[model samples]
Target: MSRRTAVIALTALAPVSWGSTYAVTTEFLPPDRPLFTGLMRALPAGLALLAITRTLPRGAWWWKSAALGALNIGAFFPLLFLAAYRLPGGVAAVVGSVGPLFVVALAALLLRERPTARALLAAIAAAFGVSLVVLKAGAALDLVGVLAGLASAVSMSAGTVLTKRWGRPEGVGPLVLTGWQLSAGGLLIAPVALLVEGAPPALDGRAIAGYAYLALANTAVAYWLWFRGIERLTATSVTLLGPLSPISAAVIGWAALGQALGPVQLAGMAIAFGATLAGQLPSRGTFSPAERNGQELSVDPRIPAVRR
Candidate 1:
């Protein structure tokens, strides 16, 4: 497969990995102190990655990885768990869907990419669709949940952009970058985990399974594939896949969590999904640095690296 296609294919994994967190939290994890759970999810998974790689970045990457880790994994993970704790499953999922929109704005500003009107419309539509799916009349929303979800979106969005702008440096594998961030984020949260929640208690069988999936699959494997894609694709185009997260979340909710969606919710999802696709079309606006800066569509980052 082409690099760009590989990027799309790989990026698609992130949301699916993320989607499983909710089900795992509800079904397996201990039912207390979400921050504690969040910190563990980050620390152990990150440390596990570090153990495997057994390598670290040199020079500027040392700090770059730390910064990226704090923004992407550290802050985002805890906020995510807290939001899930505070809000309804659907509500959290809906708010999380806003990631793509934040990515759009960040891309336009930071990456200097010109967004097609369609992509903008798609981002808006997707946000609206997420609301329809999750929100209902008279639902009481928690301020903390709202802030947490939005914060997760922004932190992740910025990480996505930065990843594109300064992808994995030469000879530095994506796995290393993933490990660095995971470790950094984990260490950052260690104090909080100790102070507020303390170390993880014993795990039940189900919790063990959940931890395995989260640490190995979601953190290690998913991130490996993601940075592999990031190395190959532009951040903006790659982020277009952000909507897949909510779509996968909804599916997991339906299948795993026994959550149900009616016709309106389905329609909203369709419109949201369609709009995202339309925005990425070359006809709307090819996501390239030059195209974003009003220059020209010379290279499409989503193309496979080998092909490029």
Candidate 2:
């Protein structure tokens, strides 16, 4: 297949894997204490990568990496859990759907990507759709959850732009960046996990397996793929795969968690997802799919190629 298609396919895996997080956390991993889960997911993954890279941030890179780690992993994660706990699955999904929309605003400020009218319109519609799907009459919206989702969006968005701007230093690969952020975030959260939660909740075998999957497969490998894809493509284009997270989460909830989606919820998902696709589509006279994916990477439509 073409390189663009391959990039798309590989990028898609990141979110599809992430989609399982909520289900896995609720069903398998320890419950209630959100910070602990976030801590465990990030720490080990970070340490493993650090060992492989043996790379440390020299000079200002130290603070930069730490800020990224905290913003994108440490803070974003627990907030995600809190939102998930407080909001209904679909509602939360729809709420988080605004993430890509938020990226548009951030990108305009950070990446200098000019927002087209179509993108803006679609984004606004997605926002309204989220309001419809999540905000019920007489049911006051959860301010904390809303803030959490918005904060996660901002953190992740900034990370996306900043990662591109910083790029990887010479000899540093995406894996190292992934590892550093994960490790840093993990280290930052460890003490809090100790003082606040103390120990992990009673976890079953399934929980252990789920945690392993989250750390190794979802957090580490998935992020590696994500950075690689982003490197090969534009930030907006690469991150467009984000909608897949909620989509996958919705599917997992339906299939595994047995969480049902109403017609309105489904419509919201459609609009939100549709907006993401529309926003990411490249204009004519850009890199082709094959050109983007080097020979080593086979292009697969099943993978979300974030090709520019």
Per-model TM-score, in order, reads: 0.85, 0.83
Give the runs in model 2 whose Cα sits over 4 Å from its true position.
Answer: 85-91, 125-139, 284-308
Model 2, 98: alpha-carbon shift in Å?
Answer: 2.2
lDDT of 2: 0.72
Report lDDT (Cα) of residue 164, candidate 1.
67
Report the C-alpha lDDT of model 2 over 58-146, residue by residue, as the tens digit: 87779888988887787777666667777765555566666666666776676566666876666676665555544555644588877
Best by the TM-score measure: 1
State how far residue 275 of model 2 sits from its true place (Å).
2.4
lDDT per residue (tens digit) for residues 1-308 in model 1: 54344457667787668767767877888887677666666777777877887887889988998888888877887788778778886788778877877877887786667666766777778778777766776766899998998998899888887876666656566787888888888888777777877776888898888777777887778777776665555565566666666777778889877889898878877876776565445443333444344432223244333211
The alpha-carbon root-mean-square deviation between model 2 and the true structure, to one decimal in Å, is: 5.4
